[model samples]
Target: MAYKYSIGHLTYTFNDLKTLLARATPFRSGDALAGVAATTYQEHVAAQIALADVHLDVFLREALVPYEQDEVTRLIIDSHDAAAFKPIGHFTVGQFRDWLLSDACDTAVLKSLANGITPEMAAAVSKLMRNQELIAAAKKCEVLTSFRNTIGLSGRLSTRLQPNHPTDDPAGISASIIDGILYGSGDAVIGINPAGDSPANTRRLLEMIDNFRRQFAIPTQSCVLCHVTTTLDLIEKHAPVDLTFQSIAGTQSANASFGISLSLLEEAYQATLSLNRGTIGNNVMYFETGQGSALSANAHYGIDQQTCETRAYAVARKFNPLLVNSVVGFIGPEYLYNGKQIIRAALEDHFCAKLLGLPMGMDVCYTNHAEADQDDMDTLITLLGVSGCTFIMGVPGADDVMLNYQSTSFHDALYLRRTLGLRPAPEFEAWLVQQGIMDRQGNQLPDAGTYTRLLGGIGQ
Candidate 1:
């Protein structure tokens, strides 16, 4: 019998799937309950549901029972027919894992379950899945999104410039930026964090980046990641604001620590959007987030740090930022204690944000006090690249003088491109070729005296 029906535009039926599963040997493992092999669609559905519940119970009791928190438990669970447990958020990370593993859940159910949980809960549950599984989910979630109109992401890999200087000195910072561009990095954006947070210092830095771009005829944008109010002030004074930068937190109270209210964020977004300053188009915002910011501000509300971090994305989405990255390891040893934690958090953060339809990148980096090294970063960068990461931070020698940390360097970007056969953003790649930094084939021009020529007359 043909078991197909149309509900609105979608044309698939539960009975058809049940019948198919009944006949499919792949679904009839010895582990499946007796008589579940499809005498009827209703019986098959019941067996599958029961088996899924068993998986949830075992997983919750074993894997996630210990780390269970009350706040998480209080969060909603997106189940049809009201999960036996009220407020699915109360379900442990293990339970989320169980639901994800059940394979019985349709796309709508998956999204509903994801909606009821916090970003951190999503992140923690992600830690239970294998890398390939997470990557597959990310691939299918390729949303038709655009930011900067320069850096193409979602199905593509990209990189960025963190041309930071210790004293916020424009000349010294310019040198680092030139080096980055000459090496064919910074397609995402030439975003810098001012060592000094004052509005005056921030303006000078912004102007300097803008000047370099104009002088070299570089087709890209710049950002001075000072406080939002300070950037807003710069915008009022008519400073060069290509992308407004802010450090957003998950909770309102945590955001208050940064002096960022939702209203203030809206003000900044509206202000920057009106400027039309971005090189590609005027979708101008850059935000950086980390797992520990809420706790650092003493505003975690007893939620796990990762969930708190993910909630920050909701704030970012409001502005439609050209770039939004989780500086995953920058917060140090307290929240994410080591390399293992950092890697897992990095993957989880990227996965969750992308799932939420944000152009997510990862600051695959670590502080000196954190128990991580170059090897761990290499692993993360590769894994994230494979998972279709939008971008990663490209610094000098893998170190940020201003931020006082290690990160992926310009050469690292090249290595990813070469190893994975990836390319920089189209416009930026053309600029690199025109500058002779990279050949037409996207290969770096022979390093013979290229650096000397690129840096010539800079100090003078």
Candidate 2:
């Protein structure tokens, strides 16, 4: 017999972690102040470097411990994972400042590589050419993505959550997401993994998005920011949801049926934000440029920039909601070919194209990781919150949670917040855990009573 059909979709993400840590130039006392007088710039640069060092020391330590065990570590892990691992990457103000002063990059090698020589340096050039080829080959080799900003997450993006495992019931999975948000688990975001099922399972998607706020039991006011079903139900079933829900059409499903390209996307977006006084609902679209990037980059079916730019303007006029970016490799081979281009078009040109122009407020997306002991965790904590994106949503591998009939990802959730700058207040944190929306160590799954009480807390 054919499969009994129920869930919306199954999102398949190819783990491509070979990007390697963004090499930083280690701090050279004189490097930052080289242009300025040593006397004048010394103290300023020194102070900044010192502060970063302190943070690094603390950050490194925190990266090693688990959330419940460490106070500060939870914040870092939570920032990157509270919700999802956004592909956009987290770059904090402090991180940026440090990125400048850290001198983490190896300048000598960079300088040697930049300056070309001949004859006498012919041997060097040959070796360099071989090295370049090696680098290219390394990038081409698909690897596990480490969590953003983690010990070595930059190029090696390993996810804190387990990516390989059994899936959960659609609504049930969504319920866990809402639990994270309402009780304030990670980043107050909802992740809907229709994989390719939502459009087919329209009703499920509709109910999930409509009941998004209710699942968390957070007051409507507190329910301002969230992510949910990509079903057009915001326009079709219920009133268009506020900035809370970030709707993304499934990869395989967003095609001829719904015209998954940017143009159709923006058209639907504008329609949702029209605000039809009695006839229409509020116009709020969570703006994310990269969501479609991989689609366009994929040689097989990615949308063109021209079309993407048009959709960007249309949504800007109507104010688009969230943008759940795409990973570069999943769609095709070219690094910038699939997902990267789509993101640039939506976020870069789309913003510059129209008469009114699209606004920033973006969302980055990525996948799981493995190695990245400490540095990567530290990095993700600083990078996930940058760019125009506000909330990050990603898959919570079954491995991230306790083994049970139902699957979840406490690690994924925790990693998300830490990668960014989000830190949940301890009181609320304790309250959420006691509720059991978060998995506790047990061989069994969450009971009906636990689910019921958890959902109850969301609305109350």
Candidate 3:
């Protein structure tokens, strides 16, 4: 169907829902590259105005991707809870935005609405919201998940201790992990991005991290961010698999580009569940998604990057993942060209995922080739902190030798925790205090030498 809006002597028309969404998206390079972005600022605003009047029910009827061709669309349609949507079912996209920012949409209310709010609905309302509105609405939604430790509790911000090495060297990775733990990071999980995808190498990395976690008796889980299939094989081999990891996208075709399918992911989830690795809870999946992943694979089907990214959260939500993050700027300048665009994308990703009741976090990062720097990261991290983000990455020195990107560092986590008075996961915090690494007030104790004994045989 066609949609149009008029401004005095000027009129703008969108050919379809996909075109309306694409033109309404905040300016980004990927949309332009795909030849879907609006050609002028006026046209973009007009599209937004038209989109604001779209009723929430329209999305349920006209999917951007055909339901017959896409399993993702099928999953979304089949799982929707019509009863849960009754209260807000009459709202238009703009009215939904108003309701989200209103006092009526408290934590409990948003939690109750999660199953009813589709990802497309979330994305639509987000387009009509500003940065602070995005943060304000998301702040009201609390999504807590657990494994060996709990995450997403109020007054807490978790960090993934990412000790990535270019060669997957055990010593180098061990050193990074030690640095992260002492600095009050790693409450989310100690996850590593291996240099190779071979099953043997992936198994070795998982076993090494598992051993380190066990040796310290740290109240945290460990993961080697390998392909889901490789992790499944390792689980079969009885390697200590804490979380099954995968990079997923919005569309089935995009996921296929990464060598995954819904069925394959379901298989991995069931396989990992059999291990019963968690003492606290059994949320065993860790998923990483980013904007432009679908477009990068030529599979977005003309939807805007932000909407496609939001759709990926539906996939994460189905798995009940322990951790789900958007590596916001890691795809580089082609998708999110600069700091401004990257920051907006991160905020939108967080807000949409939270609305859908996913435990949303962000990898506040950028590539050197992109027009961004640490100052941009600092701005984003501060915003996410106040927005009640579940976790962030803790790479040593904010640089990943393996992935060759600039991410938040162990020190960055310390800065945010100190600035915002946030603590790590309760269980991890207790371990930190017991080991003399941190005080009850979330401050790092200045006695580095006292914790050297805890390193034991690591990095040897």
Every model's Cα RMSD, please? Answer: 12.4, 20.8, 0.9
Stretches of candidate 3 off by over 4 Å are 448-450
Q: What is candidate 2's local distance difference test score?
A: 0.30
For every model in order, what is the number of clashing pairs?
5, 110, 0
- TM per prediction: 0.74, 0.38, 0.99
In model 3, where is the ten-residue run with the lowest total lDDT?
451-460
Best-first order by lDDT = 3, 1, 2
**lDDT per residue (tens digit) for residues 1-460 in model 1:** 2234343574433233223222221221111322223444444444333322232233232221123432222222212123433346445445655555556544445444433333444444554566666665554444323334455443355677888988988778878887787778787888888888998898888887777676667777778888989989999999988888888887777888888787888899999888976545666778889877877887765444655677687677667777789998888876666787788778777877776556788899999998889999999898888877888988998989988999999989888888887787777777778777898666888674656655663433
Per-residue alpha-carbon lDDT of candidate 2 for residues 1-460, written as tens digits (9 for 90 to 100): 0111112363222111000000011121212222211233333333323322222123223232244643222323332221221211243224422232234523232222211111111111111122222222222222111111111112222111112213435545555554444334332233343333444343444354446444444322112222233435444565433333333322223223233444455555555555432112243444333323323433212222222222323332333332223221122222223233323322332122211222222222222321212233223223333321222333343222312211224444355444543333233334445655443221124456766665554343
Strongest candidate by TM-score: 3
The lDDT leader among the candidates is 3
lDDT of 3 at 263: 95
Whole-model Cα lDDT per candidate? 0.67, 0.30, 0.93
Per-residue error (Å), model 3, residue 172:
0.7
Candidate 1, overall lDDT? 0.67
